[model samples]
Target: MKRKIFAGLAIRELREARGLTQLDLARRIGVSPSYMSQIEANQRSLSGTVIIELARVLRVDVSAFSSDDGVRLAATLREVLGDPTFGGLDMTQQELKNAALHAPKMARALVDLHRIYRRVEERYRSLDDALRASDGTVGSHQSAFEEVRDYFHFIGNYVDPLDRAAESLADRIGARSEDSLSRLSHHLETIHGISVSRHSTADGGGFVSTLDRARRTLLLNDSLPQATLAFAVARHLATLTLSDEIDAVVQAASFRGSDASAVCAATLANYFAGSLLMPYQQFAEEARRMQHDIERLATQFGVSIEQVCHRLSTLQRPGNEGIPIYFLRVDRAGNITKRHSATRLQFARYGGACPIWNIHEAFETPDRFLVQVAEMPDGDQYLSVAHAITKGGGRFDAARLRYAIGFGCELAYANEFVYSDVIDTRKSSAAVKIGVSCRLCDRSDCRQRATPPFDRRVTVDPDQRNIVPYQLG
Candidate 1:
């Protein structure tokens, strides 16, 4: 309320940041330095002649300092009505601002409802995560896509025994992630005779989707270069090496839904393939030998960039763990296709990611590498590097541009990766502190903001001019 300007201190901070020393400011405002200090120190009061002087000096409107919002809410109405963006709409700005102030609770609820309408899956995932960490049991999902992402989150993106087996293969054959993928494919073919094949999307969408209930044929697509190779490899391993164990894990899970079963099955195969490529002993040996250079590992194994990225996502296998990695794949438009985590990243399951996030920036640079150190709202620092790789045919006749893979992990283990060699470690991880979207991110000082979270207050009145839109107490 203007009658009770909640942020006289905020005004002082603005003055200081503008490089005006208290004495200099007092001289310009024709006030004693002692009086200015008293205002800042909260010893003297702020009203009337002082408020007018402040409005004049600070270049703010006199009404902002003189009247409470309840009184000036009518005046704030003018600024909103005059806004050209609302010119075409039937509602006036004052009506909008008054609705926003007098009943901000309703305004926030309306905003939230609109956001959910645009992206329900993300909200559902948030709810699911809240329920997961709170209770031991799982909650029902309102969005199928969210359900899918939530299901994957629960597994920590690691497949147990198969991953171990893959690690063993890594020791015997090699620890190259690509090599592991190739060998896993070979192992699956040799052991199960369940060959990989491609299918039309019209017939049945993907490898993991189509299961032969009649024939024990585990139909899979090899067209998907990285995950697919490892996938079929893991599939063979599951049906062959860890058949009983997988059956046990699946049975014990008591999970329902065909899609959920398919996802779990894919996860199991990937775990095995990861193990074969990095076999615990061989991987640990090569990881040390290569010093965890991800590019070098991909080169050594003759695999696509994403394969190596996906393999990095599986470094967590309990007793013989590797550096934990979090991998996210987003299209040029920043739609996340896949997310694998061995770290504490509560990524949004649906909707566009924050524009400030490095993943989106990586798209513009295309083939070039981007590395950034980011801190979350909760104060956890993470090291992230991203680059794009071709996904479709390379023929000028039919080739499609590749999607970028944004993969990185917490800084605590950054020393183990190839990316550790160059990035300046001195700068505060300031630019990296990004929130999801406003619906989820709760940062108090963002100016490129679209809307505040449902809980944040509009720190300043529209009638009251502040450089940045809001002031937080």
Candidate 2:
């Protein structure tokens, strides 16, 4: 069955951004003005053929019509409405979908307002502690981070100008050569007059890399791996050479305050660094050849495994896109430290992830890749791969940070990933049932549930001795 796409709001906005009228766009896409108006007014669904034509006419990626954002927004709305504060409201799935697809700005505003309310409520609950410990700057700082995160999400995690600039810089500096690190160091010293130096761990003060602008020197920790040292150098080069491009993106973003702007600039520099280290076209081609093998790709690109996973997620280069994979990093405490998705799988925004996920189990088997065929409540199945990574601890006394890096594409793309070759994606019964989070899950019979469904009524019966004590209504 073909999914109906009612992306009226997006279409209208894109048309207006291009300064095209209904008639003009209709003529360009070989459709009548009335038909175009109907399509933009949510009265009609666009065919796949027309969608391609529209993409070409609008000069945007065909993925512009993908329902991934709407799915994510709907999941967010579900989580928000599942809050006990809104438990009395009888919001239907269709209603939430409508809001997500038709009025995303309003939906996002509601989510933002709820976030503010949550923060205020938390502060109120601990008034004395908050008053004594916080200078009222924490909320703004956290809000700034959230704003920057959403900014990246809105851009589909692809910074085109910065990416292009980094790719060009990579080619000019011979980033793919066997002496890539040396080439980068030479470029930095000769072109930018910045000498690179490596310092012993004892003298580094736990810093990975430190730049002294006055001395034009970059001091890196000698304890760091070769790939990490190269990455740090590439990141510094991005900050220097791609400053103008980064500034343009930040300026155009119109973030709320200077804090968010600064964070955005730093994040864009990181994106540029990743692009430079793994130039898009070459990396994508090699990734395909390597069957999206994380270890092999990391080795081929001279980068870390986590870096390879992250770069794979950002392969949203329009027509040249790789598999639409979602990437996340979770700590031992189940807190998602990093997340980005180009697929339909949306991570929880407020609470811990589903306990059944293999990401959590990865911690038990260190350094081994754990694969799971999991299905969401919406029946979307994924071939997820999780590997536990330990960083730091260069010395025995240094703190070792443990995190699990998980990335996956939809089961439909399972053939492209080497890890999925042993699994049977065709068996629906084999897929473990998982949800975004415990609070929003509707799986009433789940014995592993930590909490009852937020929006459902529970009936507790003493006489009943089921796996769960309470029956969900």
Candidate 3:
């Protein structure tokens, strides 16, 4: 079916573009001139054998000729039929197709334009980042994973399993209170015999480390209220239930021999801690009631903003599922350190995101929120909404970093989110043109690019017009 579409179109385009008579292309492809004319008119269709023969002779994609897009292309081509000034045009559909065929640039330009326009109007997410992430290189994958880990570090310097756990506890108690952290700390030191302390003298970030081999005490240097409780809860879980699990993760990840074992152990410990708190079934329910509102849950449950954000990142639990989320913590410079994904999103690990994305824009707006129904390169679309989150720990003297968390999905799941209704889904299908990155993007007209991709050159300009010097060539 597709083959017939492209082949018929191809034959017509090639014959018409060069002003070729039926005899012209027939001799070229070794088919009878009459046969060529019939194919052009779609009175007969090209077989695979003929399809390849035409491509070999015409230098075009065989699939390009037989694609479903060809029918659309034909309809689009029909728009040109209304062109009264297309002089002396007694051309059949086959003749127009011949032009599309021989003039390869025209065929690609029209089809590419249609695809891009559909993306704009339709609102799709770009898959170029995902493709780049999947590049088969060891350094690339590790670099990405390290970026993920580092992103986690920047968020709170420790994953507070207590966020998920404490949220569940608050729901069970039928109350949401701001004093939950103090309540939690008292519950731990008094009820569970867990120890909590603050070492304000350290590098002044957050992370809970129990050097059972050396220091008998759990060391939490974040020295903040929520960090203290989170530290106590994580220490309790690791020292009590998850020690064996942590060992397993160490052995299983082959991290035991590497110095990164401690990091892996702590990371897995954080995961287990979050699992203990959220426990899948209970937290997933409240998450729905809270509408996945991070700050409200943090306030009600007495967890920190970063803690709620981190727990949200873990709703990826098996069996009792939850809304997919992507979480990240970045410095003001757009350096992302800890990022977690339960969605299809593949963010840039080493640098800032597309400036057009809402995360960066959130910084400018500060407390204001925004949503975008976005489309990507693979013909897939998603809705993205972001907000800026800060961590100065209720202390004015404390140093803080501004970060943004964006959680969204492929468009099919838009109805599942609160922000989806906040934005108009009925807008006209016009694409917001964006590239993966200038150095990695293939967009030719992008004025925002600072560099060009490796294989493509800067489309050099002889005349001054656009301020941006780089263009895809």
lDDT of each: 0.58, 0.85, 0.55
In candidate 3, position 75 carries an lDDT of 36
| Model 1 residue 280 CA deviation in Å | 3.4
Q: Name the best candidate (by TM-score).
A: 2
The C-alpha TM-scores of every prediction are: 0.58, 0.94, 0.57
> Candidate 3 lDDT, tens digit per residue, 1-473?
12344356556676577786778778888889788878876667677778777777666666446443343344334333323333324455566556554454586465445433433332324355445445533233343345336334323232334345434554553323455445545555564565555566435544444434334344454545664355355445554645665666456544212435666666666665554444455556766886666666666555566666677666643234466666766666777667665554545533565665667777777776667876554344677767787754534455675787666665666676666777766663733545334443456666666655434545667775576764555
Task: Give me the candidate number with maximum lDDT.
Answer: 2
Q: Write the residue-wise lDDT of candidate 2 on 1-473 in tens digits.
A: 45688777888889999999999999999999999999988789878988999999998887787766787788778777777888456788899988898889899888878877776676667656477555656456666777788777767789888888878988887786446678888899999999999886764356888989899999988877777788888889988877887888999999868988999998888888789889999999999888999999888878889999999999988678889899999999998888888887888777778999999999999868999998888788999999999887666677678999899999989999999888888888889999888788889878888888788888998877787778899
Candidate 1: tens digits of C-alpha lDDT, residues 221-333: 43445544454555455556676776666666555455455555555665565555545565556665786676776666655567667776666554466777788888877
Q: Which ten residues in a row have the lowest lDDT in candidate 3?
A: 151-160
Task: Give per-model CA RMSD.
Answer: 18.9, 2.1, 17.5
